[model samples]
Target: MDLISSRLLFRPMEERDRRFMRRFLSDGELTRWLPVDYPCPMEQVHLHVDRRLEHWDKHGFGTFVLEEREGEGPVGYCGLEHVTETPFIDLRYGLVQSAQGRGLAFEAAMRVVTYGFHGLQLPRIFGAAMPDNKASVAVLTKVGMRPDKRFDCYGSNLFTASVDRVAFDLKAQPVTHTGIYGAHG
Candidate 1:
């Protein structure tokens, strides 16, 4: 899949992205609010990438690597993951510390949400962020998602946000809700 924006590119996670993922996952500042999967070894990143790719092939959607337009480099990764035991799409995103606060996350997330609704034909999408993660909460809110619930996840406080099917359809005027596969579009 390839999603192009004015300043970012959302592309399928490739093998070469493992190294960047390793670094991104290991950074203390970047992973502070995220789940502690710290010190991600290269081998594990390789395996993780492989597994994500496999899931994408089987399910037609998985987390994708977010890079800059024109090869500026990978800044982050974002995508919809199945919420265990629930019929929901959990939106996840993580970015390099250096890339924070430039509106990239919001732009990338908006595009990804568009894909989830239109491309994947999903009825709803949700995201969770640690209460302290003001930045992420802002991104979700900017995309028209609303706080639905608050609960503990991964042993920490979490905030859940969502855009229901009807609400999603009503939120974006120019953007249609009809499904459109990214790979083909």
Candidate 2:
């Protein structure tokens, strides 16, 4: 397991997770706000899983598969990615349609953020989402990430959220409700 949450588990991506990735990566609605420039193909999803595994081995932290604890079904993914020009971890997450509105994204993200700050000792974490992704915005805010600014990305306004290392509220515990978790920033 990569990490554990109250009602979910963050684990290394495996070959078995490819099917889940296919379902998630192909969802145009979910991908609309993602930072990737092109459509995510299944082949690429498999490659991404492999890369995530390698990343874990090398960096001790990487994107993880999020699964519910009851039946251990995959619900989404969340993790920190290194931004090229900044000394910050880019917090990212995605979930299936069934998982939307359930707050699983928030729970999964809190675990990722906690690991990035408390476990990995990262100094800062940030996120970017399309301005229209209110759900994401709400989750980011709930977790204590403040809106840093708005920037252009692929011709769209991307809202930036960040938490300073020294100011991160690492003590905030996740609230699990109906398999959904809540956190700010």
TM-score (C-alpha) between model 2 and the true structure:
0.80
- The sequence of per-residue lDDT tens digits that candidate 2 reaches over residues 46-141 is 776677667667776778888777755888888887654445578879887777888788878777777777677787788887778899988888
lDDT to native, each model: 0.74, 0.72
* Model 2 accuracy (lDDT, Cα): 0.72
Instruction: Quote the lDDT for 181 in model 2.
Output: 29
**Best candidate (score: lDDT):** 1
Q: Give per-model TM-scores.
A: 0.83, 0.80
* Error in Å for residue 176 of model 1: 11
Q: Which ten-residue region of model 1 has the weakest summed lDDT? A: 176-185
For candidate 2, the 10 contiguous residues with the lowest summed lDDT are 176-185
